[model samples]
Target: MGRKEDQDKVQSVLELLKKQAPLTLKQEKFCNKACVERFLKAKGDSVKKAAKQLRNCLSWRDSIGTDNLIADEFSAELAEGIAYVAGHDDELRPVMIFRIKQDYQKNNSQKLFTRLLVFTLEVAIQTMAKNVDQFVLLLDASFFRSASAFMNMLLSTLKIISDYYPGRVHKAFIIDPPSMFSYLWKGMKPFIEYSQLVLVVSSLDFEESFEFNDYTSYPRVTSLRFDPSSIPSTKLGPCSSSRFSFTVSHSCDSVKPWYLSLTDTSASKVGPTNSSQISLGPVISPLNARSQSFASPIDRGLRRNDNFIRKGFFPSTPMPQKTQSLDPSMIHHPRTPKPSFLQSPALFFRKDYQVSRVEKSRDSFQSFLKFYRRPYDEMIYRSKMKPPLGGLISIVSPQLKRRHMSISQRF
Candidate 1:
């Protein structure tokens, strides 16, 4: 359709939507031109259908209090990290990642989960660029084992998005989905558009394709250096017991060592002492310790000579001997010798177990391939049985054959 025709249709839909009921300020704000266009596109440019669906969506939103959903209300659900809005796709569409593994239907009610879903959608819509009305959905199913139990929740969520938030999903990807996820996918297929559904091996593929950093992963710690100067001197007090003792070492020799001190609140002498300077014991260098005798024959054999040690060939060091004897309370009976690695069950059966696992996976994948290939084969056979219609069948037959060939080659 021409630009003028599209504008007239949008205006007609907007008028019909406004006439259906007196729109509140929230409903009016929501029924913007962009939203009207989305509904129109979703309903195949039919003004009546778009207006009716848009009106029903507005009514549903009001019933659910979509605009008034506070993030704090779903704090537990948000904290679980099951679903949240983050980043954007290559098309500047906002991305919403759903961690399927974190969801537990038994712990949370269906109503609560629905509320969380609506809230997440609202947030994603709000974060979209001015011209972008849709959002990219990523379902991280790497550790998803409860596909059967989660199917209902997944279907309800997809239904809500399809029914109320039409034309709002740019794409949907299932990342590292397990074999069991096929069942969930079958149930969800009806709600999702065929072109929008994508199965990727990993989230890295999605992030790399979009050229965006994944905020879902834990951030790397740049530095772990702690400044001892941050500790207050007034809080430092004499520790009567040594059980809570801890040592803090500095890189420079000029800096004095600090010890963890616990003050006795009930004690009369609660003043600070020279506890920070108190040494736990003499520290032994690895070189000197390597020269000492070892408790085990394995350690003795692994010990290196001075020439080899100086060259950094063998870095193994023996345990240092204590200057003091162990108290009766601190002593324990000697431990029994550990069995050799060759005699262990883990080492004995690991190879056979791994082979069996590989065989099982191969069998399952082959079965999956057969299951996936049957439909295309049937389609091609059916297409062949049908008589040619204006040579349309000829064009479509090659496309189907090529598609099947490509799918086979991909696997």
Candidate 2:
């Protein structure tokens, strides 16, 4: 249909839904399938089940501290939440809890409320018996939200650590776009100040910013990209050190590149309670789902604090070649010997030639070109031959010379 027809269709749908609304005593709010969808989060036959689930979520809102069954802690009634969906404790549920609401004419939307997330996380983390050193926090690409929420939660959490435990907690963030906004990283400049380390992960292909363009000395942060294309200069203007890193995780079919940037500056600004960022990338389809090696957001947050979200380098085995065939084991189980890219052929091969080095050494082209200019140079260099000392004319002995001369004369 044309523009006018499309508008008419939209208006008609709104009117139809409005007619079916279950209005409240207060005139401001109207309810319908959309509101019910938001409340129960139902898809398909799960509407009845979702209604039950929403009741559970609403009733529980007590202390969000270090308790394994934090939800249970709030109310000691019946049980079973995450496992009902992702059998064997899929962490996606709680991680979804941290989600910035997505806005539609019916949706709420994306703003990263870090403490908002951590409030739930503190319960997850503290409830476990694992060593603090063993935990690594992993974040998935939350679509249409700013990292400000994530960063604020991270820095404030770190500030808490710095005040009490000092270097006890370490955090890393992964940014995947079309799914997320880029500017969400604003106030995150100060994380390196509180924690011993920080890592910035991106779904773009170029090198990502670990730190913004300012500091170039502080250690403990790694910036990485997730694809093959060069990341924009504005995203990663400078680094805290030359030791900053890059990590690419897309499959052959994925056009999107991964990116990362590092900074050593400290974050001090009180960003916001709701940081709904609107920018987003193309959605990750189930077909290319395996192309990404992202963890179950909940498990990465609460259950498994493993290698994928470490203080060191991101793994180099490379995200599995098959994008959508991700192994469930990989998501939930932490790798014991985390792989390194310093030994990867891709990383090594690329490092051998970067734009800056190629441009800077243009003057040495003549010396290099000389090898190709003279065909004889190949034989000389191939044999590792050296010129005679002092430009002296060196030749074969007279006995051998006579044999060579006879052979040459005949030819």
Q: Superposing all C-alpha atoms, what RMSD in Å does each candidate have to the true structure?
A: 24.3, 39.9
Mind sharing the TM-score for model 1? 0.49
lDDT of 2 by residue, 1-411 (tens): 565554444344335434545323322232233334333322233444444433333233223222222222222111212111110012221111112222311232122232234333443333334323212343333443544444544455455434323222333334342323334443444434633244333333223423223222212221332433664534422233332334444443656454444422222111221323211221222222222246454323321223444343455665656657777776876558777656655664576446354343333222222111112211111122112210112133224544346766888
TM-score of every model versus the real structure: 0.49, 0.23
List ranges where model 1 is wrong by over 4 Å.
Answer: 100-103, 183-191, 200-220, 223-411
lDDT of 1 by residue, 302-327 (tens): 23233423234576798898888868
Candidate 2, residue 220: the lDDT equals 20
TM-score between candidate 2 and the true structure = 0.23
Error of 1 at 341 (Å): 45
The worst-scoring run of ten residues by lDDT in candidate 2 lies at 80-89
